[model samples]
Target: MFISFEGIDGSGKSTQARMLADALREAGHDVVLTREPGGSPGAEEIRRLVLEGDPDRWSAETEILLFTAARRDHLERVIEPALASGKVVICDRFADSTRMYQGLSRGDLRAVVDQLHSLMIKREPDLTILIDIDPATGLSRAKGRQGTEERFEDFGLGLQEKMRAGFLALSKEFAPRFRVIDGARDPQRVAQDVLETVQAELPG
Candidate 1:
């Protein structure tokens, strides 16, 4: 199965992705754990350009192009091959993020994102686990990380609020494969829920 985790920054999606991968590995499953924008070599280079530097470094349209470029490289080099080999692929973030961060952050150009996605990258994960959390808390946690990838976080609370709403809307928009999980609880509790949800989806 192909699984992708989505959420605001510091929503614990990354940690949960890692935990799920580890759990699946422990259960004797062949898993390929990866993350977008930095999964493949080419994507990694693009990740730096898009994620680091100033928030205004690239406009939403420009960011859409850059992110799509990175995603295409990631899909070609990492995701597709692993799935073809029957290994479970778990990605930290995917195209939905592009749909939110760039598509809605500045304006309502979801059509552009969808159009480009249909044209360039036509793949979607079998399951998308959204870690739902409050914007204020998520931002606080994200800021605590103090990482170089603060370009998005630098947008501050207002942007985070918008992102939270956008992601929730996405969860509804893609209801079938999207699982909304509360991320405010303890990590282990959240991981257990995530694992169970995923296990239910895993092919026999």
Candidate 2:
């Protein structure tokens, strides 16, 4: 099973992802926990460039290509083999993030991202969990943690709201495969909700 988690910055994706993996392991399932934009060595290098680099240097097209490149490396090195071995793969983020960030809400760059995703991740996730939160609240959580923001994280409330809408639209388009969770709750509660959802989807 390949399960991907999606959310805005500071939406508790990483925390929930780890918690999910731990719960699965405790339940006697083999699992691999990883994340997008930097899952493997090559992808990590690209991640640094894309996330921490000069915002002025990369155009919208360039940004899309870079994300695709990282995704390709991640798929080749991490996601595929684990799934082939019958292990549950829980990822922190995936292609949906690129679509939300660059395609729908940010650059109007869906065409380029769609083409790449079609060629690359032909098989979508068995399940996608979207942790939905208001932009202002999410950003505040993120700012509290890092005390500094990356380029994408710096995108103001308007863009973040649009991104949330994008995720909702995607959830509608993919019905049963998409699960949207309210992220305004406590972290433990959110994680518990994710656990229940995954258990319901993947029965023992």
Candidate 3:
């Protein structure tokens, strides 16, 4: 099984992704936990360029290219091999992120983002868990994190609100493969909800 957890920054998707990977491993399943923009060596290098530095470090179009390149490296080096070996790959984020982030940043270039994805990284997770949370709370939690990857968060609350909307809309558009979970609850509670959802989808 391949799974990806997604949400606005601070939606607890990464935490839940890790929890799910641990839970699955505890159940004797072969699982590989990884993340986007930097899952493999090459992509990690790209991650630094895109994630750190000034917010205006790259133009919207250039940023999209960088993200797509990183994703291609991640898929080739990390995601695909694990899946081929029959391990459950739980990724923190994937193409949906690029779709949503770039869509919001450059509305006119949304189509270009889609084209690049189709040409380079034409894959999707077997299941996607969308951690739905309000932008206010999400931003507050993100602000508490200590990291140089704050470029996206630096977009501020308004941008986050728009991202939240975009993500929710994506969940609907891809409802067949998406499981939306409320992320505003306690961490344990939210993790449990995610576990149950994933467990139900697991084969006997």
Per-residue CA lDDT of model 2 for 1-204, tens digit only, reads: 999999888788888999999999999999999998889999988888877745465777787889898989889889999988889999989999998888876567888889989997676899999999888888787767873227777666777788888889999988889999998998899999999999998846
Model 3: lowest-lDDT 10 consecutive positions: 101-110
Model 2 TM-score (2 dp): 0.94
Give the TM-score of each candidate. 0.99, 0.94, 0.97
**Tens digits of per-residue lDDT for model 3 on 36-137?**
889999999999999898888888889899999999999999899999998899999999998888856556677888899899999988999999999999
lDDT of 1 at 124: 92
Evaluate residue 138 in candidate 2 and report its C-alpha lDDT on the 0 to 100 scale. 82
Residue runs of model 3 more than 4 Å from their true location after superposition: none
| Per-prediction tally of clashes | 0, 0, 0
Find the candidate with the highest TM-score and give its number: 1
lDDT per residue for candidate 1 within 1-204, as digits (tens), equals 899999999899999999999999999999999997779999999999998999899889999999999999999999999999999999999999999999998888889999999999998999999999999999999999989999999999999899989999999999999999999999999999999999999999
Assess the local accuracy of residue 92 in candidate 3 as a C-alpha lDDT between 0 and 100: 93
lDDT of 1 at 75: 92
C-alpha RMSD for every candidate: 0.6, 1.5, 0.9
